[model samples]
Target: GAGVSQSPSNKVTEKGKDVELRCDPISGHTALYWYRQSLGQGLEFLIYFQGNSAPDKSGLPSDRFSAERTGGSVSTLTIQRTQQEDSAVYLCASSFEGLNYEQYFGPGTRLTVT
Candidate 1:
């Protein structure tokens, strides 16, 4: 089977610009996750989606960041009013039935806000 995939491997946007990053998870996966990796922070959890519904979004840095999964297959992470602090490698991962330890990860989208 195919692995997870993300779009716009690298993105450069000016401050205050909004961007939408996409992710396509492995087929039949019931769990999806969005994480961010930055300097000093190895990897920070952003959101988790279980069957098209996100049960927890507490890891999001601020209100400017949002995420949604559809059809339990695709997900999008949107950053509104982007800032330099948002520059990082956004990683998407998927697992079957909420199993975090066996998740397959995408290459990630590197976003740089200047």
Candidate 2:
């Protein structure tokens, strides 16, 4: 089965511009996650979604960041009014149903705001 996939493996945008990052998780997966990793930094959980449960957006850095998952499948992360500090690798992962499960990760969308 195909694993997770993300578009625009690299993105360069100016401050105040908006960016939409896409993610395609494995087929039949019910759990999906979005995370951000800065240079020489650890992964930061941005959101987590499973089935029809409400998404956990506690990790979203600010109001400018938002995401949505449709039909318990693909997801999109939108950054409104991007900033220089928004430069990082946006990673998407999916698991079976539990946090203990092994989460498969996508290639990631690297956004460089300048």
Q: Evaluated with lDDT, which candidate comes out highest?
A: 1
| Residue-level lDDT tens digits of model 1 in 24-77 | 999988999999999778889999998999988899999999999888889999
Judged by whole-model lDDT over C-alpha atoms, candidate 2 comes out at 0.91
Worst 10 residues of 1 by lDDT: 95-104
What are the RMSDs of all candidates, in order?
A: 1.1, 1.0
lDDT per residue as tens, model 2, 1-114 = 899999989999999999999998999889989999999999999988887454567799999998888888888899999999999999999889976899999999999999
Total clashing pairs in model 2: 0
Measured on C-alpha atoms, candidate 1 has an lDDT of 0.94
Mark the regions of model 2 whose C-alpha exceeds 4 Å error after superposition: none
